[model samples]
Structures are given as structure tokens and as C-alpha cells.
Target: MAERKPIESWLTDMDGVLIHEGTPIPGADAFIKRLRESGKPFLVLTNNSIYTPRDLQARLSRMGLDVPVDNIWTSALATAKFLDDQRPGGTAYVIGEAGLTTALHDIGYVLTDHEPDYVVLGETRTYSFEAMTKAVRLINGGARFICTNPDETGPSTEGPLPATGAVAALITKATGKKPYFAGKPNPLMMRTGLNAIGAHSETSAMIGDRMDTDVLAGLEAGMQTFLVLTGLTTVEDTEQFPYRPTRTVDSIADLVDLV
Candidate 1:
């Protein structure tokens, strides 16, 4: 491979790349600090829409990572942006928590189940059957389907729990309509992040742990992709995918110098 341009901007997935189950990954803090000190633009990207940027910032602060609220981007924000651009001030029947709902409201979207333009799905701690039923009925009634991400399951100490994608499947089966996901694996999310930072793809890099979502999204978005092994994906897992990240490292610790 030819020598690459020096990285001027950075994007990274939050859960697996920076932290795991609420603990900071080794060198993750230093990596973030380096970005801040060097004045390089960066954003911590996450498919999770359960919390707002403030909530995520507080969580990270508790874990000793001082990521600013603006430096964090969630699927909820991306979905809201997508909706606002697609149809400004549109109405939706939202199946999500404060994060998703708040983002929509911020973008001047009204949340309602009555004759909504879209049925928005997002990550929540509890996915109530009644809510799912309502969502299915709404979609069947002519509301469009929109999901934050296509992750089938989310990680937890108890094990994997059904995520937005799993519930989306049920809604699809009942309503015969599929949702347009606005999270990783969809280059739209990556492009949105890049635009937010005013960064060029050629001089930017995306750091992620998953081959399916993070790496693929970055690659498709025209950004250099790096895979960190501290999370869900393994070195062997890369071979399963047709595309590959620009480089792989055992942990974020190994990539600190590159920053």
C-alpha cells in the first residue's frame, strides 16, 4: 500500500472501540486526549439511540473519558437530521426513549401516532408489546417505517437483548413494510458525521470495532477505516467479510501514536 496522508480528522464507534460494558478500554482515554490536544476534529459515533449526547458525555465522564457532548453523535441525531432534511417539520409515531424523541423534537418534529408520516423505531431499555403493536398498526395504516440502526441485539451483562433490528423484523412481518435504517452500515450516517465536522474523507479516518457496521460504513463513505480488536469483532471475523479495514490493531492503545 502507498503511504497515506496524515490523518486530520477522526471518527470512532463508542461502545466497543472506546469502552466495553462501562469500562474504558486500555489507552482509549489517551487516544481521546491526544485528539483534543492536537486540535483535530473528531466525533464518537454510536448506533445506540438510548441516550442523548449529554447523557453519553456524563456516562463517559464517570468512566474517566472526557468527551464533550458535541463530540458525541448518536443514531437518534442522525435519524432526526435525515428526517428533517427529507421532510422538515414532519410528524412521526416514535418508538424510542428520550434520546430519540428529544432529537426529533429539537428538529421541530412532532411525535404522534395519529396519522403520522413515519413510524420511527429506536433503541430503548424496554420494548413494550403494546408499543410494538401500535407501531405495526401505524405502519400498516400507511405510515412509513424508519429505524435508527439494524443491530439485532445489544450487549449486556446478562447477554444479548433484542435490539431495534429484531423488533423491526416483527413490525416488518406484520406490516409488510421495511424500515430505512439511519445508522452505521448506512454510509449516510458516516457522511452526516463528516459534514458535521467539515472534514474531508481523504484526510479523515474512522475507528471502529465491527466489520459489518463501522468499517463498512466508513469504507463506503470514503474514509480510511481502522478496526480495533477491543470489542465485538475479532481478527478472524474480518476474513468473513468481502471488504477489509485499512489496518487492524489489537487495541486502541496501538493506534495512539498514529494520532
Candidate 2:
């Protein structure tokens, strides 16, 4: 086997690795501080498309994680980038919040419901049947379909909430069309993120909490993967997956030295 290159840059999931349920994880602040002090390129990644980078930065700041706006990346941004690359300045019928809409708008995509070029779906706290019905109808009218991520559920104080992927499934069942997912588990998300930071996969490492999305995406993108147990995945759960992360640690604190 070929030897691996030293990790120079970093990519990490936001929710599980840094903050959980609106609280900062122990050692997370120090980890971010170390990364900043090192001057190594790093990005905070999230599949949640409900908030823009600015909004997220504020939220994280409240939790004591001082991540800069430019260091954040989201599924909404990735989806927008994909659309911009495929069809510049295209029209779309969007079903999402400011994060998704703002991203598309920033890329010169007009949001409309009449004969749009694509039906874009993204995460939102309030998933209205009316908006979903419009999406299904527009897709039936020959509009292409695009989704930010494929996460079926999202975390909440009460419990799991239906997210973009669940709504996307409903629209797919109605129109018999599968929207292209542009988030983690699709190497596009990881590759685009790496490119955004001017980091190469060969010298970068990804820190995540889920084996399904984060680890898989990092591995596919040719980066070393670290599975932190501070979120969804348990140590026992790691055994169930066919592929393994490059390393597994207890939490973000464990990786502070690596930065």
C-alpha cells in the first residue's frame, strides 16, 4: 500500500463535531482556535440548508465557537454552485428558506413557479404541503429536479423533524423523478468544499460524526476521515458500516492537537 501524505488542511462537520443541540461541545472552541492559529485552510461543513453562512456564524458565536463567515460551507451553497455550473443564470421554482433562496439568487437564478427550468428543494423548518404540491406539479411540467441534501430527518430539542430529503421523497413519488442530491455522501460536496478553501484532498482531513454521510464523502473525495463520537454515530455503530473512517476519536477535543 502507498503511504499517505501529511494532513495540511481540515474539513469538519458543524453540528456534531462542534456544537450539538445549540451548545458548544467540550474542547470544540480550542480546536477551532488551534486551527486558526495554525493558519491552515479549514472549512466548517453542514448539510442544513435553513440558514445562510452569516446566520450560522452568529448562531455559532452565541455558542462560543468563533468560526468566520468565509470558513463555512453548506448544502445550499453546493446546490447553488451545481446549478450555476450546469446552467448559468437559470430560472427555478424554489421550496426553501433564505439559505437556499439567497444562494440561488446570488448566482443569478430567478425564483419562479411558471415553467421554471428546475424545481429546487432544500431544508426548511416549516415544510408546507402547498409548496411541495407546487414543486411536484412543476416537475410534472418538465422542470428538472434538484435537492440540497438527502438527509431524511433533522435534529431538534423535541425530536427528529422531517427535513428536505423526506419532502423530496414525497415530490419524487408524485412526479416519478428523483432530484439530484448535492450534499455529503456525494463527493461533489466535499470536492467543491475542498476547492473553495484552495485545499487538495491529498493533504486534507475530514472530521465528521456520521459514517454514512461524512466519512463516506471524505473517503470518496480522497481525504483522510475522522469519526468523532460527539454526535449521532456510536463506537458500536461504526462496526456496522462496510467501510471505516481513517480514525475514530471520542470528540472534537481529541483532534485539537492535530490542527
Poorest stretch of ten by lDDT in candidate 2: 125-134
lDDT of each: 0.94, 0.94
Residues 1-259 of candidate 1 have per-residue lDDT tens digits of 6777889999999998999998999899999999899899999999999999999999999999999998998999999999999999999999999999999999999899899999999999889999999998888889999999999999998989999999999999998899999999999998898899888888999999999999999999988999999889989999999999999999988888988
Q: Which stretches of candidate 2 lie over 4 Å from their true place?
A: none
The top-ranked prediction according to lDDT is: 2
The C-alpha local distance difference test score for the whole of candidate 1 amounts to 0.94
lDDT digits (tens) for residues 7-67 of candidate 2? 9999999998999999999999999999999999999999999899999999999988889
* Model 1 Cα RMSD, 1 decimal: 0.9
TM-score of 2: 0.99
Q: Distance from true position, residue 53, model 2, in Å? A: 0.4
Error of 2 at 66 (Å): 1.3
